[model samples]
Target: MFPIWIHTKEEVKRLLILGAGGFGHMIQETARLLGYEEVVFLDDAVKGADVIGKCCDYKAFLNEYDTAVAALGDSGMRLYWTEKLMEAGYQVPAIIHPSAVVSPSAVIGNGSFIMQSAIVNTNTVVEHGVLVNSGAVVDHDSRVGCGAHIGLGSVVKANCVIPSRKKVEEGEVIFSTRRKIDGVTSRNLEDALYAFGFGLQCSYVKPFGEGHINETYAVYMPTEEGDEFAYILQRVNNNVFKDPAGVMENIFGVTEYLRNVIREEGGDPDRETLSCIKTKNGCTYFEDNEGQPWRCYNYISNSVCYQLVEDPEQFYQSGNSFGHFLKQLGNYPASSLKETIPDFHNTVKRFENLEKALKRDIKNRAITCRPEIAFALDRKQDCKVLVEQQENGTLPLRVTHNDTKLNNILFDAETGKGLCIIDLDTIMPGLAANDFGDSIRFGAATAEEDERDLDKMHFDISLYELYVKGYLEATKDVLTPEEVESLPWGARLMTFECGIRFLTDYLEGDTYFKTAYPEHNLVRARTQFRLVDEMEQQFAKMQEIVREYA
Candidate 1:
């Protein structure tokens, strides 16, 4: 592998490319045209380091060979060879194909390779051990980290950071060194696109569908060292809810507090990551683009943290992962880091929305949903009880992960243990019961929330147990007695909350939620309501289990 702007002291020299791939051919021709007859190609199984008359496979013979290029157009491949050759005390050369165009101001470090037809635009930095493969374009002001490889035909937009040691394979990622201006953002992370000021990049490889909101894409920005980060970029789908940022802010507040609290308790400090992104001068985050809010985010590499729990004992011994997570949040001394989330799990707010929805319906019934559903919602005096309590200031509130699903709970790929908690878009101040119950509710459901078959839609106790054991192992020690007691009820409440939202979307014609079938939202709503009913039947058993486990 050769560096993109390498400093070659003396003239005519021999270079070797180690693969017979398309990139290897480009290197062979480019080397010759540039007045050097020292170009040789070698593939993985090539016998004597020589092949006669094959345009690229020549210029070498016998056991005597020169330094080689790891040619298959991926950084991981290059990293592997670079390590082997370095360990063998052989020279691992960095070379740039003649046809590739690079900016005058761009910086290229040692031991990196640039393939043919790749364009590195103005002010971009291609660091040490980086791979700028064929047809890839690094736009102006971008940063390509050390040992990172930009795959064939991929595009890294202006001012973005390509995290070190990460591989961006076959796609255009629109990330920036600058943040988006406020106002519009999409929770939809389909790949790096301009949405509500938030950058949501997704990784279409391996785990295809993981997130609950927005689309996702893999992204690695410049700034990291030999570390290959598998990041994600996604957009915010604010049209799904009336107040998108408000919901995000609420979730963000609680998680930030939990991170701080955990640190105070001498637990894992990396679990809590809340970043404040600011947009560029012309980049507005609140703009409506194609009926969705514009937003963007930096997706960290999962390989960097393949699991959520590193050790179950540590989950308990680390001063109680959950307890520490909550306990030390009050210790972070930074004033700007602390914030609040409004209307988190407040049933009263739902009632208020129900009332407003009813008044609006009274004026324009055509704009309303089913009369029965709307009327029932309008007449929901039960939620008013919770609202009055909220007003009376008797409701319990704390930091919470609103979308507390297991997939959201990242587990280590290597050890199958827990690591840090990620996906903080929905951290907010809510009842601890809501967090615990929601974790179980989503993890244990027999079928997917939007699965078409109603019969398949039931809770799986085994799966629920797996999730509960993990959650309990993480939070048992720090949980308040009220938090523990309210857990079963919390699950019921969250189930109902989800059911209400699903039904609301279904009645509203399915515009808010993405669906595979026409009545998918309705099906989901029914499933949740069914689960709620089931939970009601098992209320006693659920409480018993909680007591047994807690």
Candidate 2:
């Protein structure tokens, strides 16, 4: 027999609720209001007035009660009980409150609950075991999948498909027409998409980019002809970035400024810089239910990001791109930018952090890599080179991208030139040398950051010369002579600083950087130290290359 809708007590004599908890009690009260003469609960724990037997013994009372409701808080449990009771020849009817405004045209499946003042609009299909809670709205033509719970006051907008067993949180506006993508949908990601107002029919949503600091997703929304990547959503790593709001502020400010500058220079502002997509309430970032900060930006259509430098031209383009970026933002008030990460590029402070980590030896790992530790300790004075120069006014502070690795620069797919410098999370007031140094530290490397063999990782001076040529060619007119000369030191100290950071994270149990293995950070430290050693040996040649370009 098909499941029925319980509108009045005349249609059902006695109502049996499976759970005897608060929700079960609520269902009992609602059933009574609908004119059910008797309401009894079968619970394993609660034993009181009107309680009949344990939940597992429902089959024994099959003849006594003709109508039943799960009344369980968990959707899975509710569905399981509802199906089990239906198979036992019981009428599992939908128990909707009288105040709810459910359209006659809407299909309310059996075993669902339309609670107080809830509105299920026309043509909406609320599947079995669903709960449209108090003041919730399943707008026109939307489908609330089986066993889904529409939380109190949440709004499921028109034509949206809420997947099965998904819980729409209280007050959340579900704007997307969701289709299940493998390894894509989460409560946090869904809320983040809703917050950013991306509610069109989603083709797919998948994790994008190789950034270690933030969780990034590429959201594709269907258009007239086909599916297109519409936006880039990122969950900012609050652990690494202590002040997310401050970070967003810096990003917003810098990007807005870049937009204006790009427009003035007859450049496509959208392609040249990232355009931050504000939340529905116009906030720069949306804090999810878990207090994690999420932000979205328009996806640059014809751009590509590289994880490693494949060719000499790519490295040159990376240098040119970053150089041009610095030149473009040269006039902006650098001091106004918030230090999203305080002492981010402070080599001295980084070295101190390593010292602390070594002393603590939280993981008792210092014994495994004595050579790495000693390498860092011997170059203690090297860490202070850039910091001292900056403090004494020899190096001027500029708006620096703290992480200027080759991958951070997005190249144009058509031209194979650097299109945009993405990943602006670390934009802060810092020295020009640090920025120059960071790019050199990564782009001009002979091997991967985590290369195990020390012999394989050498400082590629030829690649370094190409980058220096590209960088100085772009910014020779804008940068100070002091900044130009400090570029070599930037390369050296930055490499050394990176080694120090890896060692620190290693000693502290590899908490900072993501590691594939227990000794991964140590391997990375060794690679950096190898590069630093080569850079130090070729220090004169590196300086000459900078001077040659300058």
Q: Which lDDT tens digits does candidate 1 get at residues 140-167?
A: 8788887798888999988688887888
Cα lDDT of model 2 by residue, 481-536, tens digit: 99999999999999999988999998998777877899998998999999998998
Q: How does residue 15 of candidate 2 score in lDDT?
A: 83
Model 2: pairs clashing at backbone N, Cα or C within 3 Å: none
For model 1, state the Cα shift of residue 56 in Å. Answer: 35
Best by TM-score: 2
TM-scores of the candidates are: 0.52, 0.71
- Candidate 1: where is the Cα deviation over 4 Å? 1-212, 220-229, 240-344, 351-395, 460-470
Report residue 465 deviation for candidate 2 (angstroms).
1.0
Give me candidate 2's TM-score against the actual structure: 0.71
